[model samples]
Target: MPLGTVLVTGGASGLGAAVVDAVAREGGRPVILDRFPTGSGHDEVCVDLVDARAAEEAVREVSQRVGGLDAVVTCAGTDSCGQFGDVGGEDWDRVVKVNLLGTAAVVRAALPDLEARHGRVVTVASTLGLRVLSDATAYCASKFGVIGFSRALAVETQGRIGVTTLVPGGMHTAFFDGRDEQYKPGPDAKLNQPQDVARAVIFALQQPPGCEVRELVITPSVEGSWP
Candidate 1:
């Protein structure tokens, strides 16, 4: 079943973009709330995820434009890769603000519309959220926060709406493009394609009511991140 009026953050690129394409392929409506426009023939609101208030307002605006929201995928994320003390304070804070706080803000504003429409939310966390790594304090912290937030939100929302936390391993995306060589995946390292992972998201979104996909972990067969 196609998700109606789904809003996706960071839907302009990477996994979020893949999910957008998947939703369209499945004949679902995908609206984008991102800092850039997602040219997928869907409505898009250009808003910075790092600003909680702006993120919330963008979500509300999209809900209003679409008439209602049936689902939301919080996929906008940032990272500051360096030893804790080496990373700048502002950069590290932005990672947390965008990945965790922004996710919360979007969902926070969308909840009323979601509850009324019985919508679902899929939050994109990382395998690092489960297993800690060095030189990634900010990313790890934000993702870990996402894990906790998603769990708590599921309980708080209860029957009003559904929430799923997607714990994905390393993927071949531009997420690592500008990172230092040390932060990049090795040549032989296995990583899932964003499109492949997008299928998992589609599956979660298409499940029947009362059968919620509360949590999901998608990783490559040889991915070393997950133990």
Candidate 2:
């Protein structure tokens, strides 16, 4: 089947923006949902995914504006790093709310439209979800929750809708703006480009109805190890 309309959360920048561009390049109508303007020609829904009511309203408004919904890509996520015992309660809560609960809220809002169209859902998780990282307890926990949630959702949907979890290693994006300098990936490290992960999302969306690419883990070949 030809690619149709796609809705991308966090589409203002990073992997989400790349996914929006990829979808547009492939002749799909792409709609962006984010807190800021991307300045792209595609429709935009400005909302904070962590705000449940706003997220739901934005999804409904986008679905109506687009006439129908065909695909959803949940790319809105954030990470925080701290030793389990050192991280404050508020910090942990904020990370989990944005990375885990926020994603679930977006999916809950979009599931009806996805089921109605038998559309695909591509969620951008992290390689950390599959492996543990020291000092990143909250981030790892949130991503692991995402992976589990996607698996359960896939089972519940049971072929009525396609669900995919995109687990990618260190990307060349500004996800670590305020992190301690030592924690950042080495400059020599060949981090995956945002576009690389976006391409994976496109690939998942292009699958046939009878097929589902349940999970994909992508790491840079130069990394030489699983992230």
Candidate 3:
């Protein structure tokens, strides 16, 4: 089925941008909620995801402008890579607020519209969500929270809304651009392209009614991030 009007957080870049492009290709209208303009000419609600209230408001605003939402893909994410004690408190907390709290707020606000349409939600988690690593306390914590939240939400909204948790491994995007050298992927590191992972998201979204993809883990074939 067509994706209908889908709201995508972080739709300006990375996997989110890829999803937006794919959605358009599949004949779905893509609406964006991001801190920066999408520049894609689609409807957008530009707001920072750190403020849960603002994120919630943005979701509502998008729904109103688009006439309602048929699905939401929460792809907005931030990370502070450092040892628990080394990362500044505010930085660490911001990661949680944006990655975890923001996702909840957006979904919370979209529930009414989504439930009305029996919509789908795809929350972007990470391989870190399934496993642990050193010096990535904030990112790991937030992603792990997403996994738990998505699971419970699926059960809570069973038969009313479809929820899918996407645990993606490293991808080729600017996600690692500003990181310290040590935190960046090695030159030869095999990472899946954002478009590849976006295709998986499309797969999940295309599932017919009464059938849903509860969780998806897409990684590079040789990726060492997962077990």
Among these predictions, the greatest lDDT belongs to 3
Residue pairs clashing, model 2: none
lDDT of each prediction vs. the true structure?
0.91, 0.86, 0.94
Worst 10 residues of 1 by lDDT: 32-41
- RMSD (Cα, Å) for all candidates, in order, is 0.9, 1.4, 0.6
Model 3 spans with C-alpha error above 4 angstroms: none
> Please, what are the lDDT tens digits per residue for candidate 2 over residues 1-227?
66688989989888898999999999999999898887887898898776877888888888888887899898888776778898898888878887888888878888888899899888878888888878888888999999999999999997799999999988888777778887777779789889988988999999987999999998898784384
Instruction: Tell me how candidate 3 scores on lDDT.
Output: 0.94
lDDT, model 3, position 102: 94
TM-score pick, better of 1 and 3: 3
Tell me each candidate's TM-score.
Answer: 0.98, 0.95, 0.99
Each prediction's total of clashing residue pairs, residues at least 3 apart in sequence or on different chains, is: 0, 0, 0
Candidate 3's TM-score reads: 0.99
- Cα error of candidate 3 at position 114, Å: 0.6
